[model samples]
Every structure is written in structure tokens, then in C-alpha cells.
Target chain A: MTKFNFELTKEIELLRLVTVGSVDDGKSTLIGRLLVDTKGAFEDQLMAVRKKKGTVKVSSAAEIDLAMLTDGLSAEREQGITIDVAYRYFATPKRKFIMADCPGHEQYTRNMVTGSSTANAAIILIDARHGVLAQTKRHTHILGLLGIPHLIVAVNKMDLVDHDQATYEKIREEMKEYCAKQGVRDLICIPMSALTGDMVSVRGDNMDWYKGDTLLETLESMSVLDDLDEKPFRMPVQLLNRPQTADLPDYRGFMGTIASGTVKVGDELVVKPSGKISTVKEIVTFDGNLQEAFAPQSITIILNDEIDISRGDMLMHVGQEDSDSKFLTANVCWIGDEPLETRKKYLIKHAASEVKAMVSEVNFKTDIHTLAQDEADELAMNEIGRVTFKLQQPLNYDKYADNRTTGSFIVIDSFTNNTVGAGMIV
Target chain B: MSEHKLTQLKALEAESIHIIREVVAEFRNPVMLYSVGKDSSVLVHLARKAFYPAPFPFSLLHVDTGYKFKEMYDFRDAFCEEIGADLIVRKNEDAINKGMNPKEFGVARCCQALKTTGLLDALEEGGYDAAFGGARRDEEHSRAKERVFSMRDEFGQWDPKNQRPELWNIYNGRIHDGESVRVFPISNWTEMDIWSYIREEKIEIVPLYFAKERPMIERGNMLIPYYEENKDQLLEGEVPKMIMSRFRTLGCSPCTGAVRSDATNMDEIVIEAAAARRSERETRIIDHGSNSMEDKKKEGYF
Candidate 1:
């Protein structure tokens, strides 16, 4: 009855991870193993999976169809393929994890991008028997573009490869090379059989030569709070909290979730687009007033002097504000079925600001298999490429590598309001 | 002086606050669907924080089935008044006028007419362009693939297959005049997380969540409470018993089931929830089938 130590688990950090691989790379099996081994999967959920008719055996030792655990849609079950992203949750005493189960089909690259967008780390599965495939490179390239801080290459299906040390090493070498080319800075390779539970959660004795930590260990120990705290201050004003109450008639507060950096009381801040400067009078929350607040904390800020800071305006550290520009160069992943037409107006939403924008030019598109830049006039659905955009107004932003929150944006079709593209400031 | 990083709970709170703020900022008229459940209690708490020191700009909509437990209505009225927010209660007057009930019509049709149709009717009447719900991805299978900003057609029909791809934290709230958006601020939260946060924040919930010796009748592995709302649904041979039970989920008295447990306090409930094998949805008879929830959602059931 006391198996779950709830008292010992307090104030645990949240880690967001995503799974990416080709369609048959055992991504679902790996996730199913993590949930089951950690006791995160409930009995009813497992029973439902076990009760499915014609369940495919993913691992020899596993009694349940692990891949069926995450395929939620009836159509997905019928086709035996994932079409969209499914989010899963689990927890250990030390941390809470939100795993984004992304599909690997070429047509569903949009789903993978959506899943990887907020992930702090990504686990890219590489079949040990197939070595590195085109889907691996494509996912790696997309992950690199999304600026996922950590990459764990799980060399799965080792049992099919006879658990040979040479095969794992070969795939690891090729992945390391390709990941490096894709600008993956932090990478770790592990050899495991997701089906057989070898080196996934508890290291099964099948792979004695593998010396690295298990997949669960690697995820649990990943440092999620990157240099976000050290980055320059950026907070997009989401709302102007003007509480004209009887007791508090003069309250004019700015509200937002600090995109990055830390802010303290009496700190000097400049409101963008107006260049108005003011000092922080107080940081307010429902609990109480705070002297200091940092990135990802939603709080209200009161200024020493009155300023016309409206929604969509950025409050930044003095001399650290990104200059506004009407033209932007960036890499984009087209997600809409409708091809990207140059000179067609689209709504570009970045942070809290939305403005009319048009694709000025398509610099080039990258081939998924060869990683080669080819000339293309239009970016089709699920295509990754570099494109230039001309905005109707000046936008203040930073490079995607420097600040993901402020640098990333989504392209929306003006007529349909569908998210057509995901762009990163270069 | 603390570290700059936020705990998991705090981070979730911050995220939820941000989303609530965004909904208020973008849409002209937005409403939060408060079901008087644990999730709705947390959502109301977050909404209170989202616009502290100022009156909430939107109203809290409660779709009443006229079959909820009496304790739920009492809690809902008192809780809304305590927070000083506007509350709008809507009912399927047409269905009620026709004498529609679960036992006679069935759970699926009853839900469709009472909850889904009632919700859509209220939303259209209020001209609300965006409505927030307390749906979590971990609760059901189909919900795991739902977008934070789920778009619905002019008639409030959801096309799950053609949903717009959501990326990053940038949400697309733009929609045509007739269309509306259903935003889930706590989409990523799990059931355990909900209980843990409830205990941490000390949020007041309905007393139904606490175990008590209430009159109940056994119905096919379900512990159905013997109340005025469900008195007529009893079979010939069934008998009511005074059992120590509590609800895992809340709905109409006839559709929801109670689990036998001794967990009366928040701490005990958290421990029990952590160790329990069955999911919370299993107790809600409306979600018995594999595709019922999905089908209901497509018909605009929040």
C-alpha cells in the first residue's frame, strides 16, 4: 500500500521529452517499457492494450503489445501506424516527465515538429539492424533546428542484431557523425532492445558489453534548466492588468510569463517599440508581492513611472533589447497542406504579437535523405527549408539559438487561420 | 532567496496562468466551463490568480444536467459567490421538458442531449468565441492527441483528423465569426499531478470527494449512490446499502460511480490515487466505451 513514496516526492522538477524515429523503430515500445517498468502505466490501460485483437508482438519477452499502448486513434490502430502526436506522462521520485510520442511517417513530420517544439531533450531511435536510415537524419536535422538541448540516440532492436557490440558501435558512429553535421551539441548513444527490456529501464543481461546508462537513467538525469536563466531578460506583455477597484484605483500592472532571464525589484527595464524606461516597483502574485522573479514565472510587474506599455510590447533589460525589423531571414518547416506561395499574405505569430507577413523568397529546401540544399520555389507540406519573410510592421526578436521563446514563430494562413509553418529566427 | 528554477507544480501553475491570460487577451468573449469538479476547482483557482486584484473579465459557465448531486450544486453556488465572479447556469430545457432521463434514454443519448447540446446552446447564446475546459491528455486515449487550442467548426463540430498542427507555445486563436476554440490550460497535467496540486494549494473541493457512509446500491461492479436523482433507476431485486465510498469522477448521479475507500482526507486520497490500478475515467460510466469520449467531443462536449 505504501509502495508509492508520496511524502518523499516533493517539488520535483519537470522534464519534457519527445520520441522520434522511423515508423517501425520501436518508439512506442520504448515508451511503453518506460511507463510499465516505472509503474506509471495503470492496470486498466495495460488491460486494454492486452485485450486488443491481433496485437503485434514487439518484444519476445514482453507479454503485451507495447506499441499499441500509445496508438490512440481507431484509424491509427486499424492502419497500424501513428498519424499524429500523442502525449504520455510518468513520474519518478526525483522528476515528472511528459513524453511526446511523435509519429515517424514522412507525411507526419508536422506532428514530430509539434512534439519536439517544447521538448528539452529528444530520444531519436536508430534501428541497430537498419543502421541509420533517412528518417533518422531527417528527425535529427529537425531536432537540431528546433534547438532541443539534449539528444539521446537509442540504438534499439539489439536482439535482432544478435546483441552484437560491433553493430551497435557502427550505428552509433554513423549517428554521431550525422548528428554532428546537424549541429547537435549534446549527444549520447545507448544500445538497447526496447522489446526485450534490455538496457531500457533495468539493464537486462542480453547486452553485457553496453557500458552506458540505461534510457531511463539518461532521461532522469538530464539537466533541463539550461542557460535560460543566464540569457538576457525578455518578457512579452500579455495583458495590462488595470484593476480599477475601489480600494486599488491606481493599479496599472503589466502581466506576462517571463520568457527568459531574471528580474528583481528596483531593476531598470525598457519597454520596446517606445523606448520608455522605468524601474520595477514591485513584482506581484496572488500569494504575495515578490522581490524577484525569473524565467517561466507568471507575475505582474509594477513600474515606478507610468509608461504606455501595451500588449505585444516587450519589456527587456537596458541595452539588451532586440532591434525591430520589418524583414526577417529564417528556417521554416512548412506544415500546411497548401504550398507556401511567395507574396501571399500570412499571419505570423511570434510570442504575443501577430502581424501580416509574406514569404519574400524561398532560399532553398533540404533533402531529407541526403541533407542537400536544393533550389525550390515553393515549400510543400512537411518540407523543411530556409525562407525570408517581409512583415507589415517591425518585429523585435533574437536568434533562435540565443532565445527560443522570442525567436520562434508560427505561420498562420490568413483565410483559414491554420498553422501553416513553423519558423525559427536565424 | 531561492533558486531561479520553479518546481514542477509551480511551472504548471505558471503555464496555466499564461494560457488563461492569452485566452482573455485574444478572444472578444471567453468563458471557462466550471463543472464543480476537482479539475474545475483548480481551473477556477488559476483563473483567480490570472486576474488577481481585478475583477475577472469573463464569466464561469456551468452546464447543469439537473441530475448532479445536491452537494455539487451547493458547492458551486457558494464557491462562485466566494470568488466574486459571474456564474451562468445553463440546462437542456427542451430535453428536460420532454422528460429525458438516463435510465429510459441511455447514457450516450442522454449525455448528447444534456451536456453536449446544452453546452453548445449556452455558448452560442452567450456569443463566446473561446471557452476553456479542464480536460487533461492523460485522462483518455483520444484526448492525448488533442491540441491545446482545439478548433471547432461553426456548428461546434470537431474534425479531429484535420486539426491544425500546434507548435511551440505560440497558439493560434484566430477563427471565423461562427467558429470557436476550446482551450485546455492543463492539457499536460496528469491525475496524480492534479491531486498533488490540490493538496499543495489546499483548494476547496466538493465534499463528495471525501469518503462517507452514503446510501448506495451495487450496479454491475459500479457503486451507484441511492439519491433522489437516481431513485427511479433502481431495479427490482437491488437494495441500497450504507457504504463508505467516494467519487473518483463526478457527473449525473445515475452515470457516475463511487469507489469503496477509507481515504477521507487529501493526503490519504493522494496516496490511494497513486497506488490505485484503475484510471479515474473508469468510474464514469459515460466513458465506458473506447470511442464514446471521442465521439462526444466531436459533437462539442467540453
Candidate 2:
């Protein structure tokens, strides 16, 4: 190892990804391999894993069980399963990565959703011996519904099947067919063995028939920047800043993150639900006033005119205002252990706005195994279903496919105050 | 990277700022827990940026164990004064009066009384509904699974198995009267990110992070810095030595170990950290035991 070229390293971008797999699919092993190969895992972490005194013994050809690296909880280690989503960080010369290691059990689908929600790409692991299992279909369906643009089907454990290219191709084709059905825009299939150190970071000789980029190369070369700035500008007001001080006694700036698109100093802006229009006087930051700002940048916006705006009011480009609706149809992923009861009041938190809401109807639950919509009265844990929500107050939102920031919301249990469900507008 | 896109550091900054502002908007009473370490320094810097024209909306709370490095205290007071921040210092007076020392009660119990119980008491006394902690997910295994908006029960205990499902950036900040939330603004940030951000932003951290010739004594294979309170802790044959070293982390002087290094400047520190093979918490003796942090967190420790 040498001193990092700080100049070149600082310019590299970040890539957020999630790993999807069922139990025994070597998901954690794959992540551990990436971290170790990239020097992301520290010596201490590896030492801890090697010396871990757990009762359950993981079967692996490697000296240490890579799966133990991610199964952090005592219960998980004891049970030899991942219970929740765990985030791991690694960096290559090309890009920095935040990989969400999602749990792979059938019942932990909600945990997978939680991890997959923010990912720009997903790595769906399939054991070569078991082709595309029902668990794989379930994971693929959930990832697609979460709007993950890129999907990499990693045909793991090729060594288990004697490094057979036919086996790899079979799983690849099955995954491709399934992903296409789910409308996955970008898909790549790779053959590798996490245990043998093959095709994960480096190209090993085992998969000579494979001609695609290694898993690392695909992640590094993949385009993470989207057309978010090209969309209509939206900034959800998170806080109304009022600094009543001697220098600036009457300063009132709306503080928020740019949800989508770009805004300049003189750009015209409108507050949603209020229909009041104003111009951006200044895009303020601690460093200085930025002349222009785009999506995901947190800044304070001062309007040229004094408008009545408070927290939860969204600033948007005029004529691109979202629809104001009190009733909405959405695809909901039930996360709470307690089943969702229809007509019971819950809280809907949408883009800085929290309002009382209730499930008006459960249209149908998606049978993940077959990807079929089944009629349902209520949703149980890990069940994905279409539901109608009646809100106490109207929300300004867009279709989830068009704009993820404005279109998504979480269902919070009013009594428990726990985030019970995650919903995306249809 | 595209010209229009923000750099990784800038994106991280924006995300942290967004989290800070969101907590301020949602929580009625929120306080930033400042420990005067490098992470806390970055956090304070972000909070300033979150509410630039106005001072940060909330006061900073420091749970003083009364056994921290004197230099940390000096830097904390000076930094707060420089930023014009409203700083609140809390201590477990009952435990201190009972003379609960690490040497007598052990590190875990001592930490429980001084840091954990002190923090819970302060939150209750201040009526804080939310607290911003500078915990990064990459620091520890258990924290890697922690939510950005972590909910705490009435007893301040963390339920690892029953955490709320945190999806995307839509954090649920709602809680009952006795419950509170621990918001980690930089949950996605890694140790390298923290040091890189510090170098890029020129953030002021305690001088202890930079290598200097300091008096120390070796205990349990760790270079423990000598403080006035640690004089009685010295063994019969052991003696303090002046060594060229710096801390990878800062906690209680007796528990935090210093590594032999000549990296006195920010650039050297960053380069050294990048090349170092060990984890950041390796130097902290309190974290030596497996699942110790998990156990502590379950008992209301941050």
C-alpha cells in the first residue's frame, strides 16, 4: 500500500448499491470478498472474524468464514442467518461504494426493501446449483418495485457445479427473463465463485467462458449519475430559518435539500399547495451563496418576495407542480410485524410533510413466489400489496416512477409511532 | 464524474446537512451530542452549514465523564466560544460522588455511570426529544445495522431486534412522550470520509489527533497517556515514558491508546490513515471485547 493520490481520489464519485440474496446464497461472503480484495476491511475486522467464538460453524473453503463478517448480531451468528440490513463501505480507485448487505430470509423481505430503497444498483445473487429459486424471484420483484435502475445477476458458486458454463448461462437466462418481466432497464449477468476468489474483484481462470466485466469493473464503470437535474425543480422545505440578530434581524430563508432538477439565483419558484410564486433571491450555504444548485444539495433559499411559507411546504418550478390529492393508490411494503388493519388511522410522512392517513382498501397482495396479484383484505409482515390511502390532508406528489423523492412516503403507526410500511405512489 | 454533479465529499456534506435540518423541523427539542473528537468537529461544522445565516437552532450537549483529556476540554470550550454555540455540559454527579472509577468498577460499569447514565439524565433534564450523535455506520458492526434515525425507548435502551424499518431518507421521527430519537447525521460516512472531509474543509480537531511527543505508560499492550488522575493507576514497576505518538481516537485518557507516529500535519494524518491496516476503534480499549458496543448500546449507551 502507498500514500493515496489525494488529488485524484477526491474527484472520484460515490456509488450506493445493495446486495440481494436468500439464505445460503453467499451474499455476505461476496461482500466480504469485495471488501477484503479492495482493502476495505481492516486488519482488526478480519482478525475479529477469524477469532470469533460463535457456536454455529459456517461451511466455507476459505480459512475464515466470510459470512461471519456481516452477520453482526449475536442472535444472527447463533442462528447462522442475517436478521436485518447491514451497510458496508468500500472504495476502489474509480469510485467509493456503500453496499447495503440485506437479509436473505423469506420473511425479511421488508428488510430487503429498506436496503434496496436508496440503491442505484443491485446485486442479486443466485446459487448456480439452484438456478433461480422462488427466493430469487421474490428478491428480484422487490428490487424492481423499488425502482432500482440497474440489476446485476451474480451466478455465484459456479465451482459447486464444476465451473459449468451451461449452468451459469441457464441461471443468467432465467434471471434476465424474470428481470425483463419486472421492467428492469439495465441488467448484467456474471459468473463467479465467492469461495474460490473468482470474478468478484479479479478475473480468475475458473470462468474462462465468461467475457463480461468482473463484478468490480461493472460497479466501477456503471453510470450512477441519472437525469435528475433534467427533471422539474423541487425543494421540500425542511425548516424555516429566522435569524433575528443584529446583523440580519429580519432574515427568513427556507432551508431544504433540492429534491430534483436545478435552480439558479433568479429562477422563478412556486410553493406547492399554496400556489404562491417567488424568485430565488439567493442560494445560501455556509461557504457562500451559490449561483446555482441542483438535486440533493442542502441550501437555504431566500425569496425576492416575502411569501407565507412554512416547513413541509415544497418549492417547485411553476407549471411543474405535483398533483394535490387526499386519496391515493400506492404499492405498500408491509414492514411491521403487526398486520395492517384497514380503516385504522396511521401517519403518512411524504417529503417533509406528516399527515394522518388510513388504508381505505387492500386491492390485492402480490404473491412473490409467482409474481401474481392475490386478493387480500389486509397485509401481513413482508407482504407487498396495492392499497388505497385516505389522507387527512392533501399531499403534493408525483408518480413514483417519474420522481422518487416526491412520489414515495412511509406509513407510520399512529399509536406506536413505528414506521410500519413503505409506500410508493402508483 | 460529470461537471454538474457534486463530488463525493460535497454530496456527503449535503446529506448530513439535510438530516440535521430534518431533525430540527420534526423534533420539538433536539440537541447535538458533542464529544470534541474529529467526528464531533465535523458534525458541528455541518450543523453550522445546515443553518448558515442563523446560528444552529439547537444547543450542543457534552456528556462529560470528568476524566477526559484536558486538551479535549480546552478545545471544546474554545471551539464552542469561537462558534458562538450554546453548550451544555452534563455529568453524573451521583456516580462521581460515589467515586465510581474505572480502576475500581471496571471500564464497562464506569462508562455506564459516567457516559451512558449521564447522557440519559441530561436528556431527561433538558426535555430533549431528539439528539444528534456523530456515530458512523462504518465504525462498528452493530452500528452498521443501526438506522439513521434510531429510536430509543423510555428507558433509553436500544432494541436491536425491534428497530424501525428505515427506508430511503424518509426517517420517522415521531415518538411517544417518554421516547426519544438518536439521529446520526453522518451514518453513511466512513473513517476515511471523516478524515478526508476534515482535510478538505480544514475543520479544527483536537491537537491530540496530530502526533506529538507526549508522556505515556504501557498498560494491557496499549500506550495509555498519563493524566493527573492516572497517577494512582500506575503499577509497582511500571514507569511513564515520553514517546512520539498520536491518538487515532479520543475518549477517556486512560482507555484511549496512542500509536507511534510522526504524522503531525493534516496531510500526513490523512495519508497515514489511508495506509493504516487497523480499524479506527482498535486503539480504544473500551471497544476491545467482542459485542461490547452492542451490549453497551442495549443499555442506553450511544
Candidate 3:
């Protein structure tokens, strides 16, 4: 096959994942083992780390701190704690993976949210000795909240417990019960020793009692494409690609990124807010003509005839028809220093559109540990709460559970010009 | 194209284009910071595509340190002419004339006075409300925490501890007067992705990136390039050695190091970069100083 053909096939088979776990739970070790055993680590990097191991004043007792392979910062090396989301790319013959190694500290929840926001799957690590801690519960709840379809509970440090089946089963049962309570349906549990390379990319003799697909095999087999493109068509106009100069006075085109679904030429579409109907004339990009443009693609669309359209306008399928726009009831993860105050006007940016929104009411706050709902007037830092928002204008959106691209938004602090919180429309 | 993969790249591209458009729509006066590097080249390319057939809405801002490779300036001028984009060049000639060499004030201080101050002064003078940068999150730890619409205070300071939560593709570029926002459209892209895109797009870059015969000296593992008049600052232990070398990253000539390589073309460079373990910044003597990038960033260094 040609190089282009190989790359096309490889791109189709790639899996993007974000790993989350509390401090020192062997998340980095798992990634390192996966990279090392798979021969993903370059020869020079391995040798350099080995030669400079204990000799470096920054590192701890050498022995190839596997975390060094991913964590690029010198401060991160000295602290032995991941502060920001570090992305690493590696490929197996079966599949390519781009893993976002997010910081596990509770304080860096924003970083974790950013990392896992674009992930198709999540690997939530749990230490066998500690069982399911507060941070583990937090991560699981956040994953569920983020609408991550696939969850892998990697019960790391199993070797410390002699790779006992009972311990793994107990932790798995607890996680399963908690996830079920939080409405997380798709979850898989595996026991492994990240430090010793057990049940990571390949099966190990240490886990003879466990029979399932290896982590690598599971990663390869998981379906990523089906989950993203199955949603409805939603396009947010980004710009108007028409030059109103003398050369192209009559030329007009609505340019935007398609948030979801496929749009083809001759398809009937409705421009939201203005409620103007138009037929797709052409889909244009920097490259040659595209017959049709699908979800997530940024392209300029020319209509058969000109209709009034501007930025922040949504284009949807006319036949399918969307539900009546109304006030949004959403589960919000408050990230600001100050607690969320009800009845405050803030800038709410959803997808490609931004509008003035006010918090109509506070529904309740979720307890990260207990997964219980409580009536609260305000939401503090790292608090998850359900709130009602009244927008100045109705926004065209889907339910967060159905479509993450259209249903999510961030609340900006008007005075400080800071992004204070994140919300997912229910 | 397959239905699935097309959807993925489309989504990423759409978001990026939306961001570029927002930078144009929201800011009163916005300019793009072009470094003549792959990242900035891709940024300019995206901008052209974002608002095609309508010459880029914003001007290109280049902070010339006067110590850059001659090839970079040549490429910059040629690219600007070809794209029909307005170019604004800023330099700290006053400081340079005052003997403010990198050797005197160290790499961090020199960069602070020359590049960062030059950029700030240009922004202030141009009355730009927003500046589009080509910084990617995958480049460094601090950058990974950066927002697509990064807000800079009145003094142009970045507070790492407190940052806005960026959700979905929606960016909030709203800021007060006298405070400008630094917009990064390609924050999600990695080093490999930049190279891959450059290769795929056939974007033209400086020839200094490819290996060629150049006068240089050996200083610690890095090949220090020798320029006129700056040879007196060489340490006693460092030896002057002539070798075929190229710059992995473009910066002030004194601080940036050259690597010995035969990868004179894009394809060979890509292969060599892929196999190389060390980061592009590792060879630079500027970053070798104690948390230099972070310290500079804290002091409003771009």
C-alpha cells in the first residue's frame, strides 16, 4: 500500500484516551509500561534516562522514573506530581493511541476536565491497597458527568497484594456499584501491575486467574467512530466567507464548523434565529471541492440562493425538526474561586454561539463521595451542581447526554473576564 | 474519505476556524504574531482559509530581535508578499545600541528586553485589543494549562494558578480596555501534528531549518553558532568547531543552539525529529537556565 493509504487506514484505527487517577496511583507507570513494552520509547530516550537515572539531582533514586517519559516539565520531575495535562502519542500494530495524561490532584480539576473533554475513552486507575478513595470516586463521577462512554478501571499495584483475585473483585464491585448509582453504564475492570508490566499491552502469567482481553486488545477493539457521528446535524456559523468588494459583490457564503451530522449539497437546511430556509450550493475548503461535509468539519457552505445569515447562527436539517427552545437545566461543574451566585447575568458560550444568560435557579449540589443530591443555594470550587439558565436568546442545542458538542458551555465571569464554570445541558 | 475520520478532522478544523473568526469579530484591533516558524506558518495558513477571498482581516506582527537567522527574515518577507498580508516589524534597536547583548544580561533578561518588550510595545502602539499566538499546549507544561482565549492583565501578566475554564469550542474573548487577550487557535496540536500539517500543506519555511555548512562552536552538548563580534563571549572551556548544523527552533542566535544533522529536507527532518528523544527546547542554552521560560512567562514574556 502507498504511504497515504497506510496513513489513512492508521488514522481510521486510532484511539484517543485520557487517563485519570489520584496521586501516586501508578497512572504514569501504566503508560510507561505500555510504551516501553510496546517499543514505543525511542532508544536514545531510554538510554539517556538510564544513564542519568540516580545521578541527576532532580530525579528520585533513578530506576527510570517512567513518569519522566510523559511529564516534560523540570518542576514536575522534581515534585513527582503531574501539574498539567501532558499528551503522549504511541501506536500498536492494531491501533494508534494519543493518551492525555491528566493531573490527578483535586486542585487541578480544571486541567483534568480539559484533558478528558475530547477523549473517547478513559482509564481510571485505582490503587489495590487504598481501594476506591475519594479521588477515585471524584474521577469516576467526573467521567460519568463528562458523558464518557467507555470506562476502564485499571486496578493498579496488584502485585503488592500478590495479584490476589479477591482484592481486585472487591474493588471492582465497589466501583461498579458506585458507577451504577451515578448512572454510568459502560464500565470494564482489569487487574494489573503497571510497574511490572502485567495485563497492559499483553497478557501476563501473573493474571492466570483472570480471563479477558488485554488492555491493548480492548483499546484496539473499542469503537470510537460510532459514538461521535451518530448524533443529529448541528452547524454553527463561524464567519461569512464572502468579499463584498467590486470583484465579488454578489458572492455570499455561510462559513462554520459542522458540530454534528452530515450535510450534502441540495439538502434543505434551516438557519436558526432568523428561521430562513436555504439549499446547500457547495461545500468549500482550502483543498479541492468536497461533495459533502460531515460533523466536526470546518467548511464554508454556499447556498443556492442568498439568505440572511451571520455568526452564532445554527443550521439544522429542516425535515428532522428540532424541539422547541426553552430554558436550560444543566449539571454544572463550578471551577471559579468564588461560589456561584444565583440570579447573576453572565456570558454563556455554547458551541460556537455566545449569549447573555442568568442563573434562574439552583437545583441541587452533588456530593462527590456519596453521589447524593442536596439542595444548595450556591456552588463552590470543584462542586457539581444542577442549575437552570435563562438565556437572552434561545440557543439551538441538544441534550448533553446525546451530544457533547452542542450541549456544553462555559460561564464567563463578566467583571473579571474569566471563565468561571462549565455546564452540560440536560 | 471515510465518513468517520472526516468527521473528526472536520470537528478540529471547524473549532479552530471558529476561534480565528472570533478573534476577528470580537477584538477591535487584532493582529497575528508570526514567528516564521511552522506553528505560526500554520496559523497564517488557517487564517487565510478562515476568511478566504477577503485578504486576512488582521495584520501580521513580527518581533525581530535582529539576531535571527537571515533565512528566516527572507522567508518572512517572501511569505508576506505572496499572501498579500500586512506585516508589522518591531525591534529594540535602542536597547541593542546600548550594548544590551544576551551575554551581558543572560538569555532570560535579553529575551525580556528584546523580544517580549518589543512585542508589548508594538501591541500598545498598534492599539491591538487581541494578539493571536501560535503557542501549542503540547509544547510545555505551563502551556497545557493555557486557555484558547488567554486573558492578560493590564500589566500583561499570566497568573498560572487562576485561569478560566475553557469548555467545548466556545471561547470567551471579552476583556476590559487596556487589557489584551492572547488567542491560541491551535492549542490542541502537538509538535508532530505541526510538522505533519506543514508537510501535508507544503508550507514554505526558512532554509536554516535544514542542515548546511555554518561556522559554529561546541559549548556543552550544543553546537553554538558563531556570529560576528559575539565570538568574544565564548567560555574558556568551549571550543570553536565548524560543523554542518541546523536550528530545530528559531530564536535569538546567541541562545538558540544548532544540532548536527544531515536532514536538509522536510521529509528527512520529520524522520529525524520522530526518532529524536530530546525536546526541541532542550538544545537551547536559554531554557537551560533555572525555569527560564516559566520565569519569563511570569514576567509577561510571550
Interface RMSD to the true structure, each candidate: 1.7, 1.4, 3.6
Residue-wise C-alpha lDDT for candidate 2, range A197-278, written one tens digit per residue: 8999889988788899999999999988788899989899988988889999889999999889999999888898888999
Candidate 2 i-RMS (Å)?
A: 1.4
Q: Please give, for residues A93-151, the per-residue lDDT of candidate 1 as tens digits.
A: 78899989998898888888999999999999988888888888888989989999999
Q: State the DockQ, from 0 to 1, for candidate 1.
A: 0.72
Instruction: Pull out the clashing pairs in model 2.
Output: none
**CAPRI docking class of candidate 3:** acceptable
Off by over 4 Å in 2: A1-4, A51-62, B219-221, B227-229
Query: Retained native contacts per candidate, as fractions?
Result: 0.79, 0.82, 0.47
Clashing pairs in 3: A296-B10, A296-B11, A297-B10, A297-B11
TM-score of chain B taken alone, every candidate? 0.97, 0.97, 0.92
Measured against the native two-chain assembly using Cα atoms, what DockQ does each of the candidate structures obtain, in the order listed?
A: 0.72, 0.77, 0.41
Candidate 2: TM-score of chain A is 0.94
Q: What local distance difference test score does each model get?
A: 0.88, 0.88, 0.78
Ranking by DockQ: 2, 1, 3
- Residue A286 local lDDT, model 1: 92
